[model samples]
Target: MARLSHTSLWMFMVFLFSSYCTAKTVTYDFNVTWVTANPDGLKERKVIGVNNQWPLPVIEVNRGDQLVVNMHNGLGDKNASIHFHGMYQNGTNEMDGPVMVTQCPVPPGATFTYNFTVNQNGTYWYHCHADYCYPDGYRQALIVHDNKSYFADQYEEEFTVTVSDWYHELIEGIAPDFLSVYNPTGAEPIPQSFLFNDTLNSNLKVKPNTTYLIRLINIGAFVAQYFYIEGHNFTIVEVDGVYTEPTEAEILYIAIAQRYAILLTTKNTTDTNYPIVTIADSVLLDKIPSDLKLNQTNWLEYNAEAPHPQADITVEVASDLNPHDDMTLIPHDHMPLLPDPDYTITLTVNMENLDNGASYALLNNISYTPAKVPTIFSVLSSGSLATNSLVYGEFTHPLVLNHNDVVEVILNNNDGGSHPFHLHGHTFQLLDRAPSYGPTFYDYKDGSPVSYDAFNHTAFPQYPMRRDTFVLPPQGYFVIRFVADNPGVWMFHCHIDWHLSQGLGLLFIESPQQMQERLTIPQNHLDVCRVGGIPTEGNAAANSVDYLDLKGQNAQVGWLPAGFTSGGIVALVFSVVSAVMGVAFLVVYGLSDLKFKGKGGGVVEGSQGEGAGKEVGSTTVREAYRDNGDEVR
Candidate 1:
């Protein structure tokens, strides 16, 4: 080597120092971009990919690998962000990936990078930060495998399966109460379809008899999905990225926010027509009819009356069940519940009178109203995308749980419409549904069950299915229980497109320590938390246009329109009217007494004087005067 010059030596030293002078870190990047164009021209769509693949091809790394992803905003005009559904990222708030909560929308052509270390192994997903009512725009799967020591047999092959639903509508700034008007015939704001890996008929073919690790994920906007191979059965060995006891799925029904790893073995190598896959419709077996009756022939409006009479669908399985075929394939594993539930909350998905002179959906009977927040400068403000038409309160609740606490949430859909309820972070076991009561639970004095479809009914069906999610049959109640083992903010919400937009959601926190460890901000990262955490239903904009100001002056108001109930307003009107009537009675009685007294002329005796003192007014005084008159005269 040539002799080094002093200047060259210093420059070399500087380069060395610069290369080694950094803290241990990594950066992650992503972008929310539209699909350029679809077969049908829907606007402002979201698509995902590192090079434009649906799941933005997996970011594979071993333990201790530094990670960095820079999220870019490429959606034409729609605002979007990314949420890593289940990631324990430490020391990274901005990268936490909540839209408008942790970070602002990656404005068109802007980029924000997320940096973290590969701390754990599991199958997780990231999607649009907007509510589940939105379609899977700019979403993908992120899988971190264990280092060599923890890796399972990988000599064969690896595959990924993503199951999700697609919507044909733009979800931004949609009102939450849209579900209330969900008549089957009514025009849907969002048309929905199912997609696998962002396309239909996505196939992965390989050698027969070879074991392939299939990672199945559901990134649907809402609702759990059932994925089945036309021919082969799968062994579900992992859930939410964690290895669990291997269970067999004759048919695979995956819940929202859930992931599963299955070992798929194709039967024959020579078979050219292998089922890459086929999607089954996830619609509820019980659908609401267009002509569902609201009133009976007798016209008695009963609260317990089912919104629609029952209709049935054929529950088809792949093969005819031999009498000896074990239907016991549906596992009955008791969830690992902690001690008794810490606190019990009963919330009903229902409809109550709204300020707009219409009946609206409710969570625990409270509809969406705006909260009283000072930072909010506008009256139409309900969420960040505040509007005059939107209700303030969406039907979401706040629950607190310990890391070890067990939670039993009973989602009773009393509304006439059906909904798919989804929980974040954990897959829950469905416990039971309260039996369908006729009209009222105890309305029958004669004790005859009310008759809509009297013939095809069970007093109460014992349906305790082990599922992470289930459909809410119309006019039905679904009780579910899950362990609060995950330690971050979790959201429970209706997957119905319009209902979620209207505000049908709530959040719960588990373990103060875990909460503090995971979420850096004291406030929750949802639309409800930004404005001081008040119930949205209390907003003034949601009040009716015809509402009168009775704050100061006493006024009697009456004859509320159909679909309206004002307990406080009714009480106020009744109080004012009742007081006026009381005063009128006193005045009339006083006037009559005065006339009777005037006619008497202050003299009294017996019947000879004033008809035997059978006086209408002052009878006692007249009798006293008559008896004393003799003595005084």
Candidate 2:
């Protein structure tokens, strides 16, 4: 009997420890509003910001923690949504936050809550998904710390460094000119300046002889930037939220939305301040205006008593770094070998001028348009993944995948410009790349297609590099593979802001049946679509002239007159009912608490409320509702 008692005690302790290791909730309240600021101290412009502060806010959390952000959109007349870039958002696809794909934009003067658990740890960021909003200022760093990281002990302190292309004109003002038919060259609006952490001449204080980890994030919209610090070398430890084998370099090339964590050791006894430089790559400068400055500088000062000398330093750019080489970024951890793919998707990316004379980026000859209804909503409501009349052809390219199925994607870039492709909700293995050089192009033009079978697929290291974003060289082909384990709708697209706006994107619908079972979208998310003046179909407004009837029949875009759809009415009614029920519950709970605390009454131990038998702590009421599987559909 004593032995059995000891066994029970051990089992009980194990259960308690396991439960404690589960995720806990971390909540943040964000007020999205407009602010006027000069990020470069040269031009004052109206910008969208969180809490009326420029550069927004940084979110830091440990791995296995639930992140809950309550966003109150106060941007007068503008809609907004925050997308947690590089987050897997496993099983919580409703909170993925790509407008019109996962959920609609949070309407102005409205509140929407995003909740998802962090399963992996590294550097990441959050940005506004609304068109041109992020470029204006709605972006911030999101860092997830991993105590068990391979390089955790290598650095004593950490800092976040953000580099972006700065524009003097408001993105709203530039959009019309950029999309105008008269501008047939498709030249992207060039940035006037560059910003390091929202400033031109930022300073980084460092301790001599100490090792510091700097998380470098390229949040620019258009061009790729090359970063280097004079008199120092970087040991790259992480890339795009995935840890990699340490590789040393004097300069690093960071594409749009890509991140790198590098270890920088201060000079042992030097009191000198080092210059940190950022310059736009010459290859990407073909479309940029010739007069715009391409380089920006900051200072990294080491703590010392004597004043440092004021001298400029010139360093060689890391032009020899090849993005196509997979050997450069070996994974630090052991990665399980991917099984033979169940599906192979070949996507050809190109640009073509439509009949209306507007240039659009296309994937597989189809320009992507945002769906009228959220793809997740459509999947759950219709109980199918088929491309129906409601889900327009150009709006969605559905690659329906089963759970745990391996998917290989071959991205064939036919355009003359490089594109940094980003895949939402998953990190893929980089298998190989074939550049469109002389011999490769010559064979293809001679009616001999370049075969991928000739490429050595096993040349990658034992644990290959896994990242969410990679640069697809102009007129090149890239191969990537990922397991379709995360359910719901995901977007695979170019990170170039202008190209993405021009419809360079596609959708992957992974395990819709599983998504229907796991996802419970909140009522507030559904209510965003019911807001006035928001388009449920296509990327344009209700009466916008940009809508095209591609079938050549000259038919109208929507069946009903604007704002008279039955679906909108049903959504409004449902939102109203949800609001009423929530209010009633709160009132009843408040009254019951008052009764319990009255002078003549005795408190009842079990009389809290319905579904309140267990103790509630940091979890909010809405989160509790979601936990109970109270879906809005």
Which of the numbered candidates is closest to the native, going by highest lDDT?
2
Give each model's clash number: 38, 2
What is the C-alpha lDDT profile of model 2 across 1-633, one tens digit per residue? 345588898999997786468658889999998889997878898887778887788899888888999999998778789889999989889888888778887888889999888888899999988787788888879999887787788889999999888788888877765653433345677787888998877678888889999998988898888778878887988889988888887767788999999999989875578878787755565444556666777778774454544325343432333322433578788685587689988888876655443456888877777665566666665444222333333446556777889999988777767788999999999877665322232223223233344245446345668999887766666788899999978999999898898888888878878877888878777677776444443322221223332232212122223444334533444565477556656655654555344455866533454545223222343332321123232
The whole-model lDDT of each prediction reads 0.47, 0.73
lDDT of 2 at 531: 69
| Candidate 1 local lDDT, 8-48, one digit each (tens) | 99999997775456323455555555553342233335544
